[model samples]
Target: MSRSSTGDRGQTEPLAALVAVSVMALGLALYGGYLSDVLPGNSDRHVEGATQDRVWNEIQTNGVFDESTDIETVLVAGSTGSNEATDLPEGYNVYVAVTRVGDDGRTEVVDSHYFASDSSPAGDTPSDGVPDAANNATRPVPVRESPGDVEGGRLVVSVWT
Candidate 1:
């Protein structure tokens, strides 16, 4: 009869270790998947409808001064700006615009205020417009046909997340 060596006595250890390693790898993979479900996604989110209404109200109030909405003088000089629009919801972009409505049903953009976006420069505007703002709010307001002439107009405010 031949005697077995000490190394040969533990010959099955490598196979047992291989099985343990496989089980550990599987556990880690399952834990990673579970974390993905529990974590929030890293992408743009859809903004709430009420948020748009709140921003609209703010712009409508901003467009008027002294209980008058004849913003022609303010629009003409291109000096109208505000920090309030930029102080709204976090991770959102804001755009406020004033447009003139003609008797012929045509609309002309008279003024635009942009704020709180990646592309907005110095909290005023991006020049190209508010990025990622798909849904914008519109409301009727009094606009100046001229410096002193009152007429119909529209106020538009857009927000994006």
Candidate 2:
């Protein structure tokens, strides 16, 4: 009887281990599938927010479109990559624009910088002056024309992947 009981215990130990391993593997497979389906959608939002943050930081740091500064000079340099302070993610395009609002609240573009990409259609400009398909994030920054001048406008940043 003692010999038989000892043999049964040994077999049960291996069986329990096998069942545990199988359950763990199934759980892992399900989790991986869930991530594959969800990650792509969340990634776009992440990129949008990140791009907005980068553009805002650059404008604040470089004083772009600020009063007493040459808008043309700053815009030219920024468009040519000389004034780019942030490193964007792969396959992303950024368009920065400065707009001024009139007394009637009508806004006009003052200066703009567009970084075009050859590979993605998202970087291409449409005939209607809008992106055909892309994710965009825009932020309006108040410009300072002069000391205590409320004649400021907005700085728009559009990021697309």
Candidate 3:
């Protein structure tokens, strides 16, 4: 008899819970599904940059493989080679292409190595990966031909999932 004044108190609890749950479900659906499409995925860019840095580091650790017969691994042993994939991330396909910078400021593909996630081979072009568009990083380096001979080159690393 004393608490009969506000009999709607019990009804408000369930109503409030239903509203809250509906709002949460709607938010989950929107954010989890549609929000990613609206947002530019920076993870791919970050991974591409990181992989580029790793390849450059490996090159520095164990120098670039030249076409000379007396090629040598400069710092680290068995890390960098001409036709092998380095310790890249498992889910990415990487394309490492080296270009010679000529005196006229042009570039020529000197050496290229592909690392595919599926353990397959990439085609003659870069568009053969899972994603046609890519996040790429390029760095200038020196190409060593023989003892006391060096030229300008650039390393281009392209990463795609």
* Residues 88-116 of candidate 1: C-alpha lDDT, one tens digit per residue: 45666666567776677888776665655
Q: Where is model 1 more than 4 Å wrong at Cα?
A: 1-87, 102-106, 118-128, 131-133, 145-148
lDDT of 3: 0.62
**For model 3, which pairs clash?**
none
Tens digits of per-residue lDDT, candidate 3, 1-161, equal 46567757657577899999999999999887776666665344457767767766665524653534121132113445444344566677777776886677787776666666642345434565435576687888777767667787787878777
Off by over 4 Å in 3: 1-45, 61-86, 103-105, 119-132
Instruction: List lDDT for all candidates, in order.
Output: 0.56, 0.57, 0.62
- Indicate the residue-level lDDT of 37 in model 2: 72
For model 2, the superposed segments whose C-alpha errors exceed 4 Å read: 1-17, 36-46, 61-92, 118-128, 150-154
TM-score of each: 0.43, 0.55, 0.52
What range of 10 consecutive residues in model 3 has the weakest lDDT sum? 69-78
Q: Give the Å error, residue 101, model 2.
A: 4.3
Scored against the true structure, residue 86 in model 1 reaches a CA lDDT of 34
Better of 2 and 3 by lDDT: 3
User: Candidate 1 has which clashing residue pairs, if any?
Assistant: none
> Between prediction 2 and prediction 3, which has the larger TM-score?
2
Where is model 1 poorest over a 10-residue stretch in terms of lDDT?
A: 70-79
lDDT top scorer: 3
